[model samples]
Target: MDTLKRDVLSQRVQQVRPSGIRKFFDIINTMPNVISLGVGEPDFVTPEHIRQAGIESIQQGRTRYTSNSGILELREEIAALFQRLYGLTYDPLSQVLVTVGVSEGVDLAMRTIIDPGDEVIAPDPGYVAYEADIIFAGGVPVPVPTYAKYDFAVRAAEIEAAITPRTKMILLGNPNNPTGAVIPREELAAIAKLAIEHDLIVVSDEVYSQLVYGTEHVSIAAMPQMQERTIILDGFSKAYAMTGWRVGYVLAPEHILSAMLKVHQYAIMCAGTAAQEAALQALRHGDADVKRMHDDYARRGRMFVDGLNRIGLACSEPRGAFYAFPYVGNTGMSDEEFAEKLLFEEEVALVPGSSFGNAGKNYVRATYCTAYDKLEEALIRIERFVKKHA
Candidate 1:
């Protein structure tokens, strides 16, 4: 029976490790009064107007499946949003594809462009999905390590060194998870130049674009000669606090979009109709709500990062996103050990940075998306825990 079960599973599915973030979340569920700073989800509710739009769609009996590419109206809104924010033009009918979420967009982009043994270069300590998704699609994930000294920004020269004859794509998560490091415009331009020279595809995940502080979010696709070779994955989940709604879209050149749509049609059919409606509403009227949330996140980031540094964690100030990646090696423990001990001793939960990649082995990632008072308390407990270890 064991042999039969083993034979039933594909090697790829069996070999891909489960998400490291969820391991801590599962432990949190078994404990009480635990202040979790691990998950990267927004604490705010989806804007009221967005919710109302979803509700109205349901009330109006608009729950049938949309076109496999999604509703035209939502696609238009997505296109308009890109134009309005970054001055990037995408044809709503041919270049935009609605997906279940940015997760699906990632999957589709990988499978659409990668063949067996093709190589994709991505940052080390990146969003956890980047490596696994590449493996699942039968491609090789080449990780170029990014260091805290450089603010965790992957250098263009390092990326150039990693390129090989088999290299097919470059995957990027701007306003990166785990580190919250935003690559600056000049570095992005250099990367764009490399892609143009190498004839490689660039998959730019801009989900956190709107959450930046004190820096403009520049899309590589907006660079000269990039639109033809870049695939942009974005969604309302992060910006509008619509994580549960699971609506996102892809913008690529028509050829790439068509190929991705084929996979999306077969695998997902379409994103939820009401959710798409809600996302449309978010695009049309959620600017104020986004600004309100962005301001709150910026404030929270400042307070939390200051607290972490004050407590001797040596966290770099995150310029974007809501995470603080702090070096925990001074505690004389591995990141895993520090997180485990902190949880048990202080009832505070955060993810070990090694979960992201090997380069993050001595760090831990804490998110400040919790309420202000909760974050303050978590900081106090973390300080106590650090002192105890000291």
Candidate 2:
């Protein structure tokens, strides 16, 4: 019997597609000398000071599980940092739940609010996990497509149009993945207003909140009367280059937070003690490291976007995050074809836009999270490939 087939897996699990981002990388892993611009992760190591804190925690034998909600000290710092950055406030004891990563927070948020038939509206061409998370939680994921013409910002009208009586929440990633578009304050306010009108909860995934270049990141949670309705998911991974640390947190109303915590306590017990200590240090003293990395990313963003245009791939200037989503339709190849051909021909690996959503079909997402010299080399190869194809 093929036990893995048909009835073995949950229907919801089988209904969701595997992550399109990892599907290609699985192949790339078997190839040699490939320069991957496919993954959205900071190539930098965790800052020395932060690493030291984690090491110190182990040395001091503080290796036990923290409170199910997380260490109060870390939660307090997170609350303070949110207030400082977005002018949002939360009671550390009741409103914050430390998570394994923003990924876990995403799952927990969906599961907490989304009953079997509930709907959650999110941007199409968003992070791949958004849809899968909603589906796994037994909720319907309604995607509203954002376009390159509009710089990929999710419009309030599009979101409202997708809403039904079934929609219980709105999910957003500010400083969006794949596209690197940041929501403007005015537009965010409009969306918050719509959420309020519809009585829908908002889950604002601000993992890349600190990575913007010229523009400021506006938290929808900070809008008038929106704090109680918006759930903020953020962490040290992106800005601090601490991906392996696996530490993130969610901030929401006490009731919502408590329900999420109930799931988290059973599913995770607590985030790693060492990581929590390290994250506390990051919140307290990692400003210099964050600034240094952001400056470097800004330099690479300008160079990469300009290089893509020069190579005949029309790309909008990414205002935030470390990716450049360029229109690759001129190459006369599908998004996946362009990516596969680029990998085989030039040893350069990029994520196909369709991996994010069908709305991204004519584009490709290239991450600038690597070093400058590596980015330059990748661009040269891309230019050569473009000439051959275009």
Candidate 3:
């Protein structure tokens, strides 16, 4: 009887699938000589100056827990960075709360604002985490599927149609993950208009803002009307190549932030002291290195997307972010089939579109985060694989 006892996991836990992107890598790990285009982290190291800042903080005995809301100096620095880069002002003391990473900020923002059974308008073929977290918090994920023809723009009419009386918030990713689709300003303005008319909160995830290709990043907070209702999630991870630093923040309305702080206090007392200090240093003095990294991603984007199209895959040229999301339908194979067959036959790893959402079922996501030579090799193998299948 004791041996037959049931598990203790919650219903919400059971409903979520383990990361779809991770499932491929788990198998890829056992395959030797595999040239992975599936890698998510940047190929570059955290720039030396940012790394040194973390070291200096520890050497100076700045290892103690920061105030539950984080240090004032760091908050001030983040506020200035926001203004300098995207022209948004977040009251450093009252409206900003440092979380473990952009992910945590996403969690707290949703947790604080959403009621159970609320509708969360998130992009389809979007980040797995968005849907997973929304479900974990008991809000229904309403996927807003964008398309290749429109450069995957988020149409306001589609957004307006998706909203229900129970729709509490819209989870927006500027320069989206997986798809690398950036929402244009006009589309954003339309969404903002809907948000205003319909009274919806906006959770704008701008983690990839600095990684834009030929355009500047526009924050939802930049629209003064949207600012009051927008919860901006950003961090030093991608911009500073500080993925492991676990330092990120949220800018929200004062009342909403006060509520989010309660969750942060109980769940994560504060972000790492050293990482916070390092982040502050990066924001204040690390623009040149940051710009250099962004420039490389832009160059790599062009190279990878061109390579994909030349090889017969219809890739929407990513305007931002390091990912090149291309449709794999030319091989007449499902996204998962294409990913798996390529891995087993050619030893190249890429994520299937279906892993993100149904809208991505016919696509695959390739990261330009690898070396140029490695990307070249993956494309070569992919060309062979496509020819064989065709």
Cα-based lDDT for every prediction: 0.93, 0.92, 0.87
Q: List model 2 lDDT by residue over 219-238, tens digit each.
A: 99889999989899999899
Each candidate's TM vs. the true structure?
0.98, 0.98, 0.97
Best by lDDT: 1
Q: State the displacement of the C-alpha of residue 87, model 2, in Å, after optimal TM-score superposition.
A: 2.3
- Looking at model 2, report the run of 10 residues with the lowest lDDT sum: 1-10
Candidate 2 wrong stretches, greater than 4 Å: 1-6
Residue 228 of model 3 has an lDDT of: 89
Of candidates 3 and 1, the better by lDDT: 1
Tell me which residue pairs clash in candidate 3: none
Alpha carbon deviation, residue 335, candidate 3 (Å): 0.7
Better by TM-score, candidate 3 or 1:
1
Model 3 lDDT per residue over 148-216, tens place: 998776789888889999998999888888888888888888889899899999999998888888766
**TM-score of model number 1:** 0.98
- Which 10 successive residues of model 1 have the least lDDT summed? 1-10
